[model samples]
Target chain A: MTYCCALRLKDGLVFVSDTRTNAGVDHISVFRKLYTFGVEGERFITIQTSGNLATTQAVIGHLNNHLELGQEPNLYSVNTMFEMAELVGQTLRKVIADVTQDTHNHEQNNYYCSLLLGGQIKGSEMELYNIYPQGNFICATEDTPYFQIGESKYGKPILDRALIYEMPLDEAVRCCLISFDSTLRSNVSVGMPLDTIVYEKNSLHIPNGKRIYEEDPYFRQLSKQWSDTLRRGLQKLPIPTDDYLD
Target chain B: MTYCCALRLKDGLVFVSDTRTNAGVDHISVFRKLYTFGVEGERFITIQTSGNLATTQAVIGHLNNHLELGQEPNLYSVNTMFEMAELVGQTLRKVIADVTQDTHNHEQNNYYCSLLLGGQIKGSEMELYNIYPQGNFICATEDTPYFQIGESKYGKPILDRALIYEMPLDEAVRCCLISFDSTLRSNVSVGMPLDTIVYEKNSLHIPNGKRIYEEDPYFRQLSKQWSDTLRRGLQKLPIPTDDYLD
Candidate 1:
């Protein structure tokens, strides 16, 4: 029901997420799934969520609650990005456990949700992680360099084909949006506008990134031109040797 | 698992399928999923299957049994493509139902399978139908001229971007192969050595179609060139307006 991706490139980290949330067909709504946390220049972190809306919101709420209440072991209290990931994963797992406690099916994951956690600490390396519904997490490595959660397959081929570890930050942004474009066109559950955030490594600050609305000229042109380019490119490919069959 | 796609284009029909079949990672094997049946010069029908291999093979077996026994309403006796579609659907449904009858869970569909049936009968229009496991089928119209079954999403965006009912048959075949290439790259469940069959509307007879092995020269060229083109094409797309942020 969502298309969210984050990449850890040479220059920085890029996070992108769709805002469409749906509960069955009739209960569709727009909700921002991108959240940023940490002390301004000391650290920068963003979490893009997908799956059960209630659970994701509840997880965010609990994390915020920790911050607001000045809990001893909160987002602000974490030092390295690894601890931040552990805290977020623990909180996510706890929230799902609390919400689905009344359900008889322990295996029922109606309340399960996942998150893409990415950002950097003051002196730490830029990092990206895919946090699982079960509170486990995996870090992005040079070979992986990125993570995508929810409605990922339709948009994945392009990323697999084009994205690289050393990609320029600007090109990576376009690549993610193009991935998003593929998803938005094929799946109704993932809609515009997309929320994106970019964090420069060691700058220890995160910008609001960009919100690409459906009507944004650049996005519109990008989507249309990409489709046109694909059509043209497909035509350019040589036909089979057995054209006589035609 | 498998990746099979069928396109109903203005020129004719194109069916493409991967040969990977795996009960588990350790038990992987190669098996053809493309099949043809008809009374040549009168009717030519091709079926591309996906899902439970046993169910699909059993369905094929039953159809062959009917023909061998000279049973009424056999594939050879079908007068129209619609009838052919119906016969395939019924056989598929019967094969699944019979196999799963001993299991108590009616909701359990471990034996489920799906098929894409396409071809023409003398004096009738060329038609393409997607037959579901429940013995129901839907025909492809101008607006929806293609059907993909099994591990479909990874390869779908390219088709959505370029395939059209009026597309040239040669181009359609190439497009289908590219789609297969995408799926094969992203999924271990779908594998190499593609089987492709092209049918010209009134040709009435069918050739054993092309087999594209992993080492095949043209296929290797297309796959390599496609990745190169995509990488180049991706670089050409305009970066976001916030390039200064980089």
Candidate 2:
């Protein structure tokens, strides 16, 4: 299981992904679920994936191996974020079809994987897209400026309360980290060693995002402080009436 | 949809349930998901249901309508908390079987629902159980003293942090309420008014259980104060470093 989230805030876009992958309890391994495309002063995009590690890796590998545009559309050649999303969906479908072709000789299984794409082109606004397992996608709009995939439930409450289209990029990144921290504490399937990337809204370049491990001072402080804050908040609330039970 | 949770604390037990039900987006109504039974002085048991409303209601109706001693074997006469949990599970399976019998011709669909049972019987300690759709149940242990059903994710973080086997009954109740408030804020499908029941250990009877509506002053205050507290907590956190964007 994985948890990846990206928020397109006023200042930039914040992307974070956990690196835990598991075939089963005993078969868990660390696999980077994030991939970046392009370099400085050009089109930059970061992709995060969850579900069916085999399928996700295959789709990403196929795209990476054939990124050039010779009338053959691919991630690097896509002109806009919309086109990039379509390319991702098309590639996902192609890869799944290739892998499932021999299923009858084996056992039939549904291919499952989803992706989060967020980046900025030179002239366009930073945007975020949630690509579904079925090779389709939806973009985040002003009404909802973030997309989350994987073990999303344990971390959803804070985002629903604090995330907004107008939030500063720095604050939004903090919010995403706190959200991920909540999920990591609650679910064993999502572990530490997070990969985070930030793309300034109009920079059209990739900034070197931090790789947070168990010892990252800022993350450690945030996790401890957040839990402490919640405990304090809960303790301060007045006790309810004992009338009904008395 | 609904959200129901039961916590077993050293001092007692806490149970909370939301009342909103819907067949589709256009058909939403309020229906209590909690049912209580007791012998006044000997025992008290509270059950909260989630999943298909019809299935849950049918199961409850089966318990309420049948009065014969051996024939019913309902929650009312159960000797132990485990037996009470098993009775709820058996009732659920029976209800599903009865409903699915006509599915072939009527296309009414499968029955799906779960139950959270918690309370005490004479001369016994307070306990909690999560009864599944398949007529099997699991008891909450000292390490895991809480169970949640229906639209559960949004409200799980607080419980993960604040719940402990030795938490005070009052504090447990407050934690459950805050959890419910978080769920209600995030998911429209789970709404109030709510039904909350707290059982004091060894008493074998529930005295602090009641229905809470939107206008309930205590609930209103708790929700408002929780929101204010959360906002303040977020504000107190340190601002992200400028490196956060990189």
Candidate 3:
């Protein structure tokens, strides 16, 4: 399982992805799910993936192959963010088809993978898109400023209450981290060594970003502080009546 | 969809369940998912149901019928908390069997319901069990003193962070409420009019426990206060570096 989130805010866009993947409990491994591509001061696009590692890697491979070949209608060749998302969706579907057709997956293995695409190309607005495995996608709207994939529910409540279309980029980043921390505490399938990127509008390069891990001072502090605050909050609430006491 | 939770604390026990059932988005309706059964002072057990409303209602009905007939192995006849849980699980399985064989369900729908059973018997300690649809159950542990069923993920993170086996009864209850609030905010299928029961250890009867509705003053205050606290907490976190803000 993965927990990947991307938010499009007034100031810029934020992307965060946990680096844990598992075929089973004993077969767990760390795999970076975030990929970045851009030209300095031109266009910056980042994608955070979740689902079958093979499928995601294949899709990324296809994208990279296109970049190497300078193919038409690829991520780099696309003129708009929407077109880029469609190209990704198409690539994902094609790769999934190629792999499943050659494999003998009798249990009807699910090609479950989702992509979060966020960035800004020159002469356009910063955008966020959640692309599905079926070559379809949905963009974030004013009312919905973010998209989350994989083990989403545990961390969703905070995002729903705290997220706003006009939220400052820094606040949005904090909200995203808190959301990730909430999920990391609850689920073991999602682990550390997070890959996060912050893209300022019209700035095509990832000049401000991070890869947070177990030893990252700020992330460790934030996790501890959030847990402590929640404990304190619980302690401050009034207890039930005497009949409800021990 | 439903959201039901139970917390077994050192002081006592807390159980809460929402009242909403939906076959589909268009077929949604209000149906209490909580049932209480016991002889006052001898035992006080509450069951919160989640999943297919028909299956849950049928299970509860069968339990009631067995009690009414004064049958062997009935809830009233159970001397131990473990026996009580077994009885509940057995009853749930019997109900599922009856429904499955009736020839009324065209799709051969398997019974889909989960139960949270918690309370104290006069001679035994308070115990809580999470009973599955297949009549199997697991008791709460010292390290993990709570169980949640149906639409559970949205509320899980807070419980993961705040709950401990040694938490005070009221603090646990408050945490449970916060959990429910989080679920309710994220899932429209889980709604208001929450039935809550708090049982004191060795005291088999609750003198002041009741259902909380949308307009309940304390709950209203709790919901608002929790959201406010979370927002304020987010505000205090340090902003990321302004390297990308350029």
Candidate 4:
């Protein structure tokens, strides 16, 4: 399983994803699930993928191939974030169809994938989208400014409570890390070396992104502090009053 | 869907369950999912259920009918908690089999149910078991002192971090409430009017249990305070340092 989330705040977009993937318990491996496509001062795009590693890799491969070949209507050529998401969704569906055609068991095979696509295009507002396996997609709205894929429930409560559209970029980053930390503690399949990218809205350039490992001091401190703070917070809540007995 | 959890502490057992059942988003109703049986000073047992409402209701109905009939090898007549759990599992399997036998589409029907059973007999140690749809069950160990069924992931992190085998009964109750509150916030299918019970070890009697409604004062305070405490706690954590760019 994977746990990847993206927040489309007023200031920018935040993307975080864990790198662990497994075919089964014994066949676990580390695979980067975050990919970036950008043209400095032109446009920027980031995608975090989950489910069917082969399908995700194939979709990413096709995108990269399109760029190398200077293909029209590619990620680099798309005029809008919505169009980019559509292209990615179409590519994902095509890859899944091609891979499963020989199996004669498309329904049973369950070879599907999902993605979070977020970025900016010149002269347009930044946007974020959740692309489904069937080549359909939905963009984030003001009321719902975040999208999470894979192993999402464990980390969702914090995001639901703490995330805000107008929060500072740094605070949003903190919330995302805390959310990721919650998921890591509860699930074993989502492991370390997280890839995180913070895109400042309208900057149209990819800022410095971090690959956090187990030994990263800041992440270590953040995880420890969050845990301690939660325990302390729980302790502070008033115990059930005796009236509960009645 | 339902969210029910049981914890086996040194003092006794704690059970909590939400009372919402839905065939679909449009078809939802309130139904009690927690049941208790006791022979004062002899034995006490509690079962919290989730999954197909009919199957769980049938299983509970059968158990109640057996007691009413004064049947031998019933809950009141069982010699051990293990035997009691085995009987409940068998009864559950029978109920599911009976309900689904008439349907031709059993594979796709998914009329499965799960249960969390906990309590003690006069001479036995307190025990907790998670009974599966297959009529098999597993007891909680010191390493895993709690069990949750249905919509469990949202509430699991708190239990994972705060639950201890030796906590006081009230503290265990507090922990369970926190867990339930987390689930309630993140999931719409698990609603208010929660049923909770606390048993004291070797007492063989049910203590005062709570049916917490949406307007229950203590619960309302707890919910508000918990959310405030969590938000405050998140604020207290140090923000990510700029060194992350390296």
Q: Which candidate is the best by TM-score?
A: 1
After superposition on all CA atoms, how large is the RMSD of candidate 3? 2.6
- Which tens-of-lDDT digit does each residue in A125-205 have in candidate 4? 999999998889999988999999999999998888778898888888888998899899999999998999998888898
Clashing pairs in 2: A244-B207, A244-B208, A245-B207, A245-B208
Please state the i-RMS of candidate 1. 2.3
Model 1's lDDT to the true fold? 0.87
Q: Give me the runs in candidate 2 sitting further than 4 Å from their true place.
A: A68-72, A101-109, A241-246, B66-76, B98-109, B239-243
**Which candidate would rank higher by lDDT, 3 or 4?**
4
In model 1, which runs have C-alpha deviations exceeding 4 angstroms? A243-246, B243-246
Worst window of 10 by summed lDDT in candidate 3 chain A:
A237-246
Candidate 1 lDDT, B173-241, residue by residue in tens: 888888998888888999988888899877888767888888998888888889887888878988777
The DockQ values of the predictions, listed in order, are 0.59, 0.57, 0.51, 0.61
Candidate achieving higher lDDT, 2 or 4:
4
The fraction of reference A/B contacts recovered in model 3 reads 0.53
Candidate 3: where are CA atoms >4 Å away? Answer: A101-109, A238-246, B101-109, B241-246
In model 2, the fraction of reference contacts reproduced equals: 0.60
For candidate 2 chain B, which ten residues in a row score worst on lDDT?
B102-111
Per-residue alpha-carbon lDDT of candidate 2 for residues A1-246, written as tens digits (9 for 90 to 100): 899998877778889999999878999888999898875787889999998988999988888878743446876678888998988998888887787787874332456789998887777777789998668999888898888999998888888877888877767777899899989988999988999887877788677878888898889888888888888888888888765345
lDDT of 1 at B97: 77
CA displacement after TM-score superposition, residue A178 of candidate 4 (Å): 1.3
Q: What is the overall TM-score of model 2 with all chains considered together?
A: 0.91
